[model samples]
Target: MTPTIALLLIITFLLSTVGLLVLIWSISTNQFSNSQNAARTIFTPGEEGHSEDPAREDTSAYKGDSKAAKEAFTARRVQDQSSKPAVLIWLSSAVFWLLIGSFYGLLASIKMHYPEFMADSQWWTFGRIRPMHLNAVVYGWSSMAGIGAVLFLVPRLFKTPLRGTPYAVTGAIIWNIGVILGLGAINFGLSDGQEWLEFPWQVDFLFVLGGALCAVPLLLTCARRTVEHLYVSSWYFLAALVWFPFLFFIANVPKVFPGATGATVNWWFAHNVLGLWVTPLGIGIAYYIIPKILGRPIISYKLSLIGFWSLALFYSQVGIHHLIGGPIPTWLVTLSIVHSVMMSIPVITVAINHHGTMWGSFGRIKESPTLRFVWIGALMYTATSLQGSLMALRSVNVITHFTHYTIAHAHLGMYAFLSFILFGAIYFIMPRLTDREWPWRRMISLHFWLVAIGILIYFVSLTTAGWLQGLALLDAKTPFLEIVQMTIPYLQARSLGGGLMVAGHIVFVVHFIFMLSRRGAMTQGPTLFRVRTKEISQ
Candidate 1:
């Protein structure tokens, strides 16, 4: 490696080490203690006597003298602690966006086969529709749904009510509006032309505003939590809450950096939006789902901490690896590659923790829809990260770069891993929110099979086809157009996979709508797969 690459690697290593040390110190100092207490504690009036220190008397001496005063304080606290309304609004926003985004994706997929499908319509053109599909999925579906999930999960994990429900609601509204305006602008030819950050400067302000609004509730909820043992999921959620706004704001700043610097920052922000924002939300959900299904605590809290810190440390520098073989400095690419390989530490740590937690519970997966989705998602996470590390290598990138292989890798991470986890989280959370079981266990089972099989077909065909295409391009004897022609069959298969996947999504959406309308059968317990009488008795 060149000196610059060596220096970059050293810098990344030092930063990660320092961050890990700080995390260790914080854990040792009990800083994360009482994280879950905020859920119910805010409902109680003034602080009570500490069980550990009886001499520490209640401080509200004046209020203690009046029974009415104490009751009023308690009532106010309950009002402050409620989060149901905020969660509802956020979820509604997510569902609306998800439908719209999914349709855009369908349109884009079809346009790939029939480029002239909407030839006369400017708004429906491929360029406009492609970005719309991305923005819709990233901002509309994933981010909104993630926020909703976190809003629900954090309170339960922290054992506290969300502190600023109104603020969260406001943020959701602003975020949805921003998404609409941004998509509309891009369709109408008002784009800044950045890949992920395509929205105009004015629209970026709304994102910042929304982000700031959301952060308040998260911080306040963390501050007021009552649970003493901060779960691994909570840690990931809290860190992501802190990381996202910082990266978003820094990346969008105009004219503050040179052209190359801006490109580096933009890609960094683009990549981390997945790593820091979506990845944490997905991982957090997995952390909750795996253990909840098994009715056990995590396998090892120490491994979780190691995974969390290592991810934050190593994943931050991976964007530069994307710029490898480009005009960017060789040092930057080399540094990114090293950090990319180092990512194995976190991936392995998380895999060990998750697998160890579920070591004896594989049988449970058959009966539990949530477990099936989550376990598959967890496994995909390992596969994608390892694939990513290999792809970051210069030798490997030479073949994979600008090919369908990258697309396959992206879907492996985004759809199979992250989207599956989100689906599992929704399955786990919706019953609690609605106070009703799912409409049909059979529908859920069908949904899982369709999506699982569809993704497998999609990945296998495209990956194999992409590898051949890449090899053909590299070979001097192979004709370029013939290589393109060779991919037509795989692309057709991909469309079939997309069709099945879309059908699965439609099934889920229909089920969700029916559940929301209270049209499903009323049941007391969670909807589980029917078992033989003997097994049920056991």
Candidate 2:
């Protein structure tokens, strides 16, 4: 076994030992006797019987706290207004980088089929631009937008204004600068040479510093929250805030591990960035948006908690499954496989909560742009997660590991799931932030169709192509050149799909700019999709 595996074994053993001791200590002290009190601590006085969503059914009669609830609701809106400046900065940065990233992604996709498209410029080579696209979207768009949503949610959830707006704004600026510098470095061939950690180590500190600065206000706000019981969404936000920086720091420590150990660390960091960092942000936002728009609570609070804790337990280990066939120890890979399968717990639990919450309210999607985007995103989360868990198995990994199938899966998670949720959130938050309706509902609908159709085409074409490619690889009679030729049509299809998504992004940016400039429709009602009188269900 390699040194890394040995060290991991030792660490696991020690941790298990410590956990066992803690369990014994707790049992001896009769800690389980008051487990109900601990469980009940998650609920505030007069809130346990009420729906968690602020827009929930009339629960004022149940708790006899109608006046208090009204006051709290008003305070949340005021807090949202106060959070506008800083939140907008983060969101604006997110949108800007999103546009930039989409173009880079399109260019990269085009190069896949037509390699000569950008051959004239070394700066635009696939190697450089691909990493540029990844970083721009991952750190630039997704992180910034997720942070913006968190900034917006925290104040309302905690019933307080964000504590340090100036610092958060500074952090957004610094974060953008880091992305710019990192992408520039990639363009010049100065990458650190890994899939996710492509940014040179020199600029890594900017992200660390910027993320820390952004985190301070949220942490302080949480600490000083007016609400006694922490909501499930808050739990996700707080955990993501802590997980991301720590993961980034450890992963980019600059030549700490070498050879097999380095590869192990690389996959561990890469996968966790998705499962731990971004997944929480996406799930947290969905948990809020789904119920908030539906005017109801999740189907089961206990199930939500189960999902959260199970995710924390299973996701951290599941990352190692990416290195299943590598030089790692067999036992370690098996452990990860076990965790991967166990991930079904959280995935099903969350699916039940999110989809069940939106059960009877599916018709609302016609009138609510936010619900349309978010609901589809939530569905994709279930699809991509189950796909991921299945792929972690050795049998499935052998076929799909190095194929474009993985790429399809990644986009399914990142774009269809995470980006879609972010889009919905922006749609919901922007009008409230600007105090203006979107100028055109048609534009929003067009944007959604373009991207939605694009991803559908993108996912289907690549999944089929990758499966065929995998089969050919397994066949000894198949020529490598023949496999390459077979995938060309799919690659071209990917570019076409990417082009549509890019167009959608452009439309979104234009709409966002209009809203920010206060040029939106001068109407009091929200800019919802037009529905025929007969189609209106509620």
lDDT winner? 2
- Residues 373-397 of candidate 2 have per-residue lDDT tens digits of 9889999999999999999888998
Q: Give one digit per residue, the lDDT tens place, for model 1 in 240-317.
A: 888888888888777686777777887898889988989998888888767655545566677777799889978988
Query: Each candidate's lDDT (Cα)?
Result: 0.76, 0.83
Candidate 2 displacement at residue 24 in angstroms: 10
Quick one: best TM-score, which candidate?
2
**Model 1 stretches astray by more than 4 angstroms:** 1-81, 257-259, 523-538
* TM-score, every prediction: 0.85, 0.89
Return the TM-score for candidate 1, rounded to 2 decimals.
Answer: 0.85
Model 2, CA-based lDDT = 0.83
Candidate 2 lowest-lDDT run of ten? 54-63
